[model samples]
Target: MAGTTLGAASPALAQKKPEAAKPAPPKLSKPVMAVVMAVQKLQQAGDHAGALAKLTEAAAVPRAEKDDALILAKLKLFSAQTIKDNAKLEEGLTEAVEAPSITPDEKLMFSKFVAGLASNRKDYGKAWTWYEFYLGQKPDDVEITVQAASVAAALKQPARVYELLTKAIDLREAKNETGDRSWYEFRAQTAIDNKMDDKLLPSLLGWVKAFPEPKSYNLAIGLVKQRQGNLDNNVLVDFGRLMSAAGAMTDANNYLEYADAALDRGMPNEAEIVLKEGIAKQLLDGSKQNIKEFVAQAASKNAESKAGLAALEKDAKTSPRLALVVADTFANLKQYDKAITWYKTLVGNAMIDQDTVNLRLAFALKNSGDAAGAKAALANVKAGPRAIIAKFMDVVIGDAA
Candidate 1:
């Protein structure tokens, strides 16, 4: 638009009217000029095929001048557009954008046009090239960046997609702008799809934080557990607890795994509760022998343990290990107030790991929806691996609240 024009007839001059200004015409060689005129006449005559033939002939003519090359590129671009030839369209647009006479705006427009065109045709390599070009020139354009990320995904470049989206999302966050939810969804989905272990949790966290709901919470907590290999039962129990608190325990695996974790932690009452809920929700097959046996075992153990709770509580006063087990059982069973009481009793005990006890207290407090108390408890977790875990839990509690 800025550097080239079709040889349309001049508008008739009105009496005593001044002429409207026009952009300078692109320079063309005499041989190319003659061909362009012929091609223009054929185009005006509605003979597109004939016009394309003339343009092809002109393409073979020697063009020693840069201006001639620019003019030929414009002619090819016009011909490509007229016939809707996608391949030629990209080629022409690419050539035109590289010309010295092209304006910045024109270059940007061409870049986007070719990128979209190529993507629509499933020409991912070309689309990615143009998308990168456009993004390099307009790094802050979140919309374009997302399109580029999509193209990157089409090209099977997961890391590149992650990189592009992270930059775009970070840019928006930096500017305090939030509108599109897909940005975070795409990031999380990409990481999940690719099994990017390092990035999966953070991406899901971003998604759940932006759109906190049962489904998002379920996905985030579930995927993090799925992707992270060999997590401790304690960690699995915490994840299950978080999902349960958020009303996100929707999957059969989630129920079974949660129950298994609680059972492993010696909290059969909690395991029974989880398994019973799963059966009630029809998420677990109660007719199956394994499921039936697991449920029956948990129930029996829970009943026996419940009958012994009084004696255990009496013994817990003198043993931090017993106190922690009782506290954890209460936490797993969602009796968080009782759990908090038991956990607090062991917080300052000289014989116990303060960090571990305090961290457990924080989890109990958080499960009870006392986010402030949870954070206060987390502060007592001073150092060691438990402290590191506590810091992450602090973030989780804050987000859940």
Candidate 2:
């Protein structure tokens, strides 16, 4: 009888134990879950406007509270991007700002978006305010500092730029445990722009000591020395050391300017020596072989040298000022045809002022024994002071013709 009863209970008891007191599945609010699902579907379909509209409606729906802050912030960003309406965008942003659950990353993203929108509308003040807010939250942000400095520069607030850059430099130095050499360069340039030469001198000196090989620093120092009427052997020696360390290349316009300064100061002997030394070092080092091409090109156009102007001309195509220099060099060498060719190129490309090109073409034609071409070129000259001058010169040339 016991065996019979146990067997009878066993099958039912096993089944009942498996089903007894099972925890109910967590109940998701159907309406809220549906709204979230709708938002996700709309976003996935690239219908951001629809997504935001759904989110806005869901935000107003009572009792749909879980993940609300996240959903609202997302809706705000999507709405801001979709509407192109600043008022609505700001409204969304205000909501986001109020959402205490917003993460720092989300805040940064929203702030940048607002700042870009404000900037596009030329609302610089608003842009600055937004950027400032973002920076306050992330104080050591170098990219923001650089951007703020640039914006301040564009706004013509040099003092503000200076302050921002100074702070950025200090922050960078503190973070790296070392001083920033570029900051000194920026300060020197700012001082130059402001005509605060006395301030510039110290900054320049500091940059030179810090970044001696940056050629520009040396050039700045040389300029400062020249401005102070100190173009003596001592200054030359310092420049020479910088040139050697930088493997001074003659092709650089800065080097040419330095040479010209030396020559202008009655130091042609020194200028020649420096050029020779630079050329020798450049040839031996092979670091600045391009300078050789530059020098050869200049010499080829020299009436006394005629070295390799063609190669230089080819390279000059990449540099407008160099093209002009080549043309002038040809003119000075009495290669009037080559000069006229370049001058015509300049005119055809509209690279030079129309009036200037016409006058130069007139002169080139006259010198090339094409008095008629000269007269015709002058005819293209527009009526201005330059045109009047060209007409008068034409009459004189015509009389001679």
Candidate 3:
């Protein structure tokens, strides 16, 4: 007993509009009109059972014209609605909408109305069908589209939910409208639940770009990292950098992964930086044996690695990978000028991907407080995952870039 009712005044008893604006009502026979009036009076008097009985009698009247049938159907709908008889109301509504006298506008309204009734009854499949019908007629109805997506979700149709909500969200954004936060959340969550990895990044990127909340940033970066499955250490380092820049290093695992990836890539200085920052942020328990081991390992080679950087820079010209490794270490150590120089040195080298070089240069430039330089470098990144990450970084740097 939710105590909910469709409490609006019945359409049958709606006050007539100005003659110029109103469509002509279906002409009812003498018998059907008399029954219709009686049912309305009974409903107004709160005699729902009598109102329904009168409509049932009206249904039996011999109908010579389509208007007679249409009037009878509307009377049944009004009576059924008065008594809150959902089954009869659904039947009456379907009959009324199919009548020859029903306008396209009326049919669309009925589609939405019946869809709501089905949702209230938790008949999601029926609700989805009705909602689809309404949306087919009026695809621009964002609110209804979201409702339909919700119904599709309840029916365990994740792909359909993704399709409907993505269209709605993109449509709103195209109009320069900010969508409701929940819409983005639903779209992202649906992608995650379905393990739609291909869809996850774009879904999250759209969400974080629009909302730019810390929690969403964490999810956007972290979820993709979690699902990427055995990335190259260099790629993992890039992921770690993005997560760190976004302030999305929410757990010890994030710190550990970043540090381990740096260590594996022969960048002890970078590992040391990540481990130290994690400890300072209280996100890593330094007293833990594994963390203690990492801290000591990161420190063991860190100084020696820095000492060898001059020699490394000499060999960097022949090895773009070596240069990138050194650049990443410099960036991690907050030596952004050296990092940017090395990243730029590798640009258009043909031996290494120019997009990678540019994207890395952008990261270093942005860290160095040169947003314009960062954006220029980012603009050169137009291939693979780095391009996508570059797009996200552009949003992070904001319009100032």
Candidate 4:
């Protein structure tokens, strides 16, 4: 490398020139100064009222007009602090909001002060207005957004609360941040109360999928059952399956709906099974009158199946499938003896799933007034997903007994 003489004149390497001395701050005009001195004297004497009066007098001075905005705001702020009156603080804030020389920090203080004052006074509408203004300056502030949502809710503005809370949750999600579970609940209840029927289920389902919480799942499934079940049988079954699997199907209405849907789909066997299980859990009626509405068409089915079951009995001597039909139909119809006999025959002699047949026989024997036989049949069902249910049923039935 060649030796180079670097010149100091080069702009890139040159030292910066010394800065000039700052100018003195502008002085208040004579009348303004006089009023300020008077206010200061009153404040020193702890006569805040007198100081505020002096400040009010200064406001009318035509000469103080140029700086009057800041002067008036400062007076109000001092009075607010002295009297500990948020209303005075809010007055100062309202004036300060229009002051050109107010710092961003001061403006933020003003906004928060006014919002707190309004909130404390239970003037939620006005609080929402101030908070909206503040949050408008900081759209991504999740905490503030949630606070605004609470204020909106207090104001009985369900739609607004829903919007703000969901926004807060979404912002948190975008940042991959965890959120308050209550936020999810707030949005859900808001959506429901606001008659946001379209948004309610989707929001709850989102909560369930996102959080996988049991309470959220229950609310989501309950909303689905209460609001959308009447739309179609498929909706009922599809949603009921998820609800039941999640153990969120605690409501009798939900059990009734699941059975009702199965029945409407011409799945009487499934419906009958669901109803029996629900009744066993005391989630549905065990009495004939109590279950009357649910099995309205069953009497007609029983009469029709009578001939078919007779035919199945005749053919069952040759076909195990026919025997299974008799077993399933009679089991569904509460003809437990026949169902147990057929189910037991299949469990031992047929080339079918013995565990499945054993499970069916357990239910049949239990319903046929044979607790011992049911226990014996259930004991044979060892190791499978169905075993979990068998174990649960055993414990539950044992508890009841």
Top-TM-score structure, candidate number: 3
Q: Mind giving the per-residue lDDT tens digits that candidate 3 earns over 1-401?
A: 01112444545422223556667667877877777788779878988778777777666777666687667676667667666677777767767667787667777777776777778788877777788889889999888888888888888999988998898898899999878899889899999989887888889888988888668887777666666567788777777777777777888888889889889988788898899899999989889998899889989888878888889878877888888878877886789998988888788888888877888898899889998898899899897667767877887887335
Over the full model, what C-alpha lDDT does candidate 1 score relative to the true structure? 0.75
TM-score of 4: 0.56
Task: Quote each prediction's TM-score.
Answer: 0.76, 0.43, 0.83, 0.56
Candidate 1 lands at a TM-score of: 0.76
Model 3: what TM-score?
Answer: 0.83
lDDT of 2 by residue, 125-174 (tens): 76677777877887787667766666666677877776776677667656
lDDT on C-alpha atoms for all candidate structures: 0.75, 0.57, 0.79, 0.66
**Clash count list over all predictions:** 0, 1, 0, 0
RMSD of each: 6.6, 25.1, 3.8, 16.5
Question: Candidate 2, TM-score vs. the true structure?
Answer: 0.43
lDDT of 4 by residue, 249-349 (tens): 67687778888875675447557667777888887777868596566564445456665778779899777767776786777677887788788788876
Best by lDDT: 3
Tens digits of per-residue lDDT for model 1, 241-290: 66676678888988999999988878898899999999999999999999
